[model samples]
Target: MNIAKNMEAIFVAAIVIASATSFATAAVSTPVIAVKAEASAMQTVTVTAKRLTAAEKAAL
Candidate 1:
């Protein structure tokens, strides 16, 4: 009976550990695309300028 109880405890612990590892791996894999998207947006904005801004500056 004692051996059976020990085996059950170990099984539960293994499941909990496996769940934690899966979640950790998933967390590490995300967020790379968001960083790439932001970099592309910055590049696009840097290449274009609003010509009207010059006229506005002259009026000022």
Candidate 2:
């Protein structure tokens, strides 16, 4: 019974460590993801502007 309890404690500790590591990794990568999303948004805006300009020219 003592050994079983020890093994359970170890298992819980391992799970906590893994979860903490995952959170840390996500935190580290969040800024990178935000930057990528910002760049993508800028590109989309630029493309939309160009399309509008072309459409205006066509209308004229």
Candidate 3:
């Protein structure tokens, strides 16, 4: 009977610990935003230029 009671107490303790951990994790989590304007503002732009053909160059 004592062993059974001890097992029950351990099971309840494990459940309480698991629930507290899950609640803490959910409360302190950040949401993921697909379109973040703040992040986009810090991006850099790249530009490239190509040479024109001989005829095109003569027309310019």
Which structure among the candidates has the greatest TM-score? 3
lDDT of 3 at 57: 91
Runs in model 1 with CA error above 4 Å?
Answer: 30-60
lDDT of each: 0.79, 0.75, 0.87
lDDT of 2 at 15: 100
Best-fitting candidate, scored by lDDT:
3
lDDT of 1 at 19: 100
State the lDDT of candidate 2 residue by residue for 1-60, as single tens digits. Answer: 687769989999999999999988988744544434566466533334334577788998
Better of 1 and 3 by TM-score: 3
TM-score of each: 0.41, 0.41, 0.42
For each candidate, C-alpha RMSD in Å?
14.6, 13.5, 14.9
Worst 10 residues of 3 by lDDT: 32-41
Clashes per prediction? 0, 0, 0
What's the residue-level lDDT of 6 in candidate 3? 98
Superposed Cα deviation of residue 4, candidate 1 (Å): 2.8
lDDT comparison, 1 vs 3, better candidate: 3
Residue 16 local lDDT, model 1: 100
